[model samples]
Structures are given as C-alpha cells and as structure tokens.
Target: MNTRFKQLLQLSAAALLVTSSSQALAWGQIGHRVTGEIAELYLDADTREKIAALFPNQSLAELSTQADSELSNPSEFWQQTWTWHFVTVPEGNEYSLDKHAPKEGDAYTALTSSTETLKDPKATVEEKRIALLFIVHLIGDLHQPLHSGNGTDRGGNDVKVEFFWQPSNLHRVWDSGIIDNQNLSYTELTKWLSQKITPQMASEWRTTDPKTWIKESIIIRDGIYPEEPKLTYDYQYQHIATIKQRLQQAGVRMAAYLNEVL
Candidate 1:
C-alpha cells in the first residue's frame, strides 16, 4: 500500500482501539461508539441526498469520513450548543431535589432546539455532516450517568481514585480502563454485540430524548460506585448485557434522530 493508504489504515486502527476501550470505561463511554455507528447508519434519505447534492462527485463514505474528522475535536462553540440539547425538563420537586434533573425552565431547556440542528439546512455538506456526527455522540454522552452528574465533579473528574491496579484518576479510569482490558477491535466488538441484540430491543430504544437516557445511566452509575480500590471482570460483566443493549440502542436512536430532522 502507498504511504497515505498505510497512514489511513493506521488512523482507522487507532480510532477503533479508542472506541473499543471506551466501552469498558472512558470519558465518553459506549455511547460515543454506538452513536458513531448510528450516525453512519441512520441519516435520512433526504439528508443523505442533500449532502450528496452539495458534493456531486464525493461518495457517501468519503463524506461521512470528512464529517467524522471535522467533529473529532469539536470547537468550544459547537460543544456548548450541542451540550444544551441533552438537557431535559426535570420532572417535579421530587426530581428537582435530584440535582441531575433540570429545573422547570433552565437555560438549557431542550425544547428550544429542534433535531433539525443535528443537520443544519444552510451549512456546507461537510459542516452539516460534522454537526450531525457531533449530535450523535452528544446524545449518547447525555445518556451516560457521569455526564449528568453534579457539575462540580466534572462528571466524576473530581473523584480521585485507582482502578484495576492502575494509577489513574476517577474520570480517566472510567473513560478508558475496563474496556481497554478487553483488547478487541471495533468490528469484533460490534459483531459480538449485534448478534445479541433482539428486534424488540432495537425497536424500543429508538428515541430522541436524552433525559430518560440519563436517568437510566444514573441508576447504573449508582450501582457501579462501590468503595473499592480495584475493579474485576465480575464488576465489568455485571452490566455487560445492559452495556451492549445501550450501545445498540444508541446506534438505532442516533439514526432516528437524524432521519427525523435531516
């Protein structure tokens, strides 16, 4: 292979490694990988067609690649705006007391934004692709329990600790430890997960709201935080099934979100 092709393959390999490790633990979690997969799958035909219109000569794969790159390291402007969409209206005083729930009318009230933002009509094809991709990941992130935790912790960043004998911070461990322990490729992991997903689950998890997702994560997060210095395979397997389910759901839902607005 040419040097450029070799480099591309290496980059893809690295990304795959990053994504697989993210499953067990990472700043992002399976949400990122699942959403990434979904964004690649769920874009509406019209949006896909529109993006093609903008780039008459480019293949869909190429466009998607460009989009992923643009979103790899989002700008501050993109982060804040995309972050807001994940906020949900808190249920009531009951939920209000729970810091995770938003107040009746918070600055980030989700209703204010449409899924259309996921694919801005006026932006360039690459720009829209980037936006859509980010939304996919952000939606998944919103569903992560730590992402919705108390602001002071920076989503577990404040918690100092070790994991699996590794000298690491709380957030860092969860971001990339346990899953890194798996030592698998993205294709291998996805295949293993896809085989386990039932049709009923795929249908049920397809939704746009992030609050409900976050609530689910909060429950999982609660169960995960035990006063222990080391985590074992048992701890990892405790929710392996659920973790796979979440990733599958994220992919399907991400596609739905883009299909609706794009």
Candidate 2:
C-alpha cells in the first residue's frame, strides 16, 4: 500500500476506536460544556478578551469537548492525551509524581502542562490553543471523582451497575448519568448551578493546585460506591448534590486557572 493509503487505514482504525471508547470519556460532552460555561462566567474581562482572540468563534463550552473529539485524530498527541483525562491515586495513599503519576501523563500533569503552555511567551498560537482545549477538558474531568480513582477497577469502569434500570458502569454514572438524568440543557444546568456558587464558594475554590483538586476528588470517590449495584431514584438522590457541587467547583476552578494564566 502507498503511504497515503496506509495513513487512511490507520485513520479509519482510530475513528473506530474513538466510537467504541467515547462512552468512557470524562464527563461526556454536556458536563464538560457546563463546566466551560460556568468558567466563562467567572473569567476576567481581560482574560476573556485574550481568549476570544485565541479561539476566534469558539466559546469555552464548544472548546470543552475538543479533547474528547480528538480521540479520533490519527496523531500521537491524541494517543498520549487519552490517558491525560484521568489519574489513579490508589486508595489510602496521597498522590505524588514519583509514586502515582506515570510518564504517560494524567489529568493532574495535563493541567500543569497546559498552564505552562499558555503562560509561555515563546509558545506558538496553535500550541497554546491545544493546551487551552486540555485545560477546558481536564479541569472538568478531574472533578468527576472517578477520574481521580483507585488504581484498581479502571476508575469504576469495571464496577458495573444498572443506572435507572439500564446497564451502566460506575464511572459512566458519575461521568454523565447523574447530570444527563436531569434532562436539562447544558445552559439551564449551568445557570441553575452557577446561582448557587456564592462569592465565598468560588473564592475558596480558586486554588490553582492540581494536587489539591485531585485530593478532593479522591476523598469523594471513596464514599460514592453504592451498596446496591442497581441504581435508581434513591441513588440519584444520595449523590446528585455531590455531582452538582463538583461541576460547579470545576467551573470555578477552571475560570480561576485561565484568569491567572492568561
């Protein structure tokens, strides 16, 4: 086969892989957009202007899904970035670069790397734009407790369950089920949750430290497993608040990072 034909075959395989694996992406598209919209609200005026210049017609909400969509791209960057959506901080141990972070990268390292990219004067526009997409995606991903998971169970992907009478995994339930279960559009969800975020809440959540964010997610992950694997209204009732809080916090923190970096 010619080089061009070989490239086409590889691209087709990657696209198939993306289709099979998109369900496992952090926060699905809606949850990530919700965080992006909320982050849009909290951006500094100057930062907003700068971001507009970089993104052209794109809003953060649209950009939020870019990384997940890129899973289909026939590129090494996308291959490496698939791992950057989540991390394993094994139960009972705090995260450390030497102990927990792998050379392959994780949401924590991705955030730090993106921040540095945006902050670097020498970085090209395309480089910073790719980094910005990651910030938009990874910030929300880390907030999904399972993304900062125990090394086992594939971040609860292995812990299968029935969500509202349908087959699902624990990770999917947290990633999109709880929020998607509401049937609200991303804008409505963002508006509803954004109102509850007080000045103090956003201020308190403004830390740029990814370790602190991962720590918070790890604590929440431990308590989230349901005794009954078949989840319904009661399960939603018990955990919906945590989902809302994390979504809101992710948005707040995402904005804070952009405000500080850009």
Candidate 3:
C-alpha cells in the first residue's frame, strides 16, 4: 500500500480500538442505565407500550446501537444536529452577560431539535425513534458535571492527568473512571441508588427541569476541576458512592423524561 493508505489503515485501527474500549464507558451506558431505571419508575402505560411495540425482544444494547446509527444522519429534520451537542452555562461569570448567561446552550434546544427530526413527515419511524432516543440520552448528558464544562477546557478535555496510574484527561475521569472503579454492574448500581431515593427526593430531582440541570452540572464541574488528579483507589474510594449516585440519577431522569414524552 502507499504511504497515505498505510496511514489511513493505522487511523482506522486506532479508531476501532478506541471504540471497543469506549463500549464500557460510553455515554450510552450511562444513558441507558438511567433510561432503564426511569423506565421502571416513570414510564407510563402508553409509553411503555410504545417502546415495547417498537423494540420487542430487543436488548437495550441493541436498541441503543440502532438509535445511535440512525441519529448519525437525520432527515432535513432540525437545525444541525451538532448544535444540540452542547450545554449552556448559567449567568454570573465576569463575562458581563445578562442575568442568564448562556455559555453553552440548553437541553431544550436538543430536545426541540430531536423532536423536529421525529416530527418530520419524511423521517422513517426508526429514524424518529432513534432521534427521540438521542433526545433521551442528551437529556442525561446535560446533567453530567463535565458535560456542562467551561469553554476553556472543553469540559475537561484539555485537562490532562493520570487516573489510577494511567495517563488520561480530566474529562475521561468523570466520563468513566468513577463508575468503572465501582466494579458493579449497571443494574446493581441502579438498585443501589434506587434504595437511597426517597419519594420526596425523587419528586424534587424530577422537577428541576433541564436548564436547572445544566446549572447544577456546572457547579459540579467547578468542584471536579482536577488540581493534580493523581487519583488512585483511595481517591476513587472517597468518591465512589457519590459517583454511583450521579450516574444512577442520570439514568433515572432520562427514563423519566422519555416516559413523560411517550
């Protein structure tokens, strides 16, 4: 092969490796976990029926894969899909903005965009379902601490550090480190969190709304800014419970939103 072709092959191999590695920690894992929990608690009779009708006999993994691929390209559905990929910062920085400083954007934009795709007459049922599912996932992502990161770090992507003696970025830590450290299955973690949730707590957690979710996530980002992330088992130990709670909530709320919509 020519040099260019050789480089292309190398890049493809690396991408595949990264994809395989990410399967365990991808946004989908967290989202689906949340969706499952929320589905259990929040999905109504109709939405549950719809989901069952659309995906009978399919695993969550299968549905998620199908949704992601369909969402990769949408009908002339909404404003660019890329626009929905960000989170908005709350007002109060020195940037001299209004009371509502919009740093990133809102989950509403994403939901609206996804809705547009779903509503497009030309859109396929699978495409619409996938778009709706993405809306479900993005709602959960908007609540993750790093997902609402400052423009400076691109949500900690710029902050390089080591996680358990492994070289990694700060963003990666929040994305996967804490959850992976627990060594619990997603169901176990969800059950663990579900037990702690009181009716009142769930009630309050569900009402915060998406804009509020982003604001809350931004606050968390401040605390998570790694001074020197030499995190080992001890560090993970210190925050293991907290991490599980956050991840669990992500799933719970995602399902809640979808249930409401359906």
**Alpha carbon lDDT at 241, candidate 2:** 94
Alpha carbon lDDT of each predicted model? 0.48, 0.83, 0.55
Clashes of each: 9, 0, 4
Taking all chains together, each candidate's TM-score versus the true structure is 0.64, 0.90, 0.72
Question: What tens digits encode model 1's per-residue C-alpha lDDT throughout 1-262?
Answer: 1232223223332232122111222224333554455445556778667545645654332322231233333343322332332333222311232554344322123322323333445443443434433454455555555555545555566676666665665555555554456675554665666666677866787776655666676665656554765655665676555555666676666667656665
- What's the CA error at residue 191 for candidate 1, in Å? 1.4
In candidate 2, what are the lDDT values of residues 1-262, reduced to their tens digit?
A: 1232223224343332243234338888789999999999999999999899888878999888878887766565465567888889989988897888777677777777777767878666666677777788998888889999899899999999999999999999998898899999999999999999999998898987888888999999999988989999999999999999999999999999888888
In candidate 3, what are the lDDT values of residues 185-233, reduced to their tens digit?
6667667677777778666667436666676676666776655668777
Off by over 4 Å in 1: 1-31, 38-114, 118-127
Candidate ordering by lDDT (highest first): 2, 3, 1
lDDT of 1 at 3: 34
Model 3, position 111, has a per-residue lDDT of 57
Kindly give the stretch of ten consecutive residues in candidate 2 with the minimal lDDT sum.
1-10
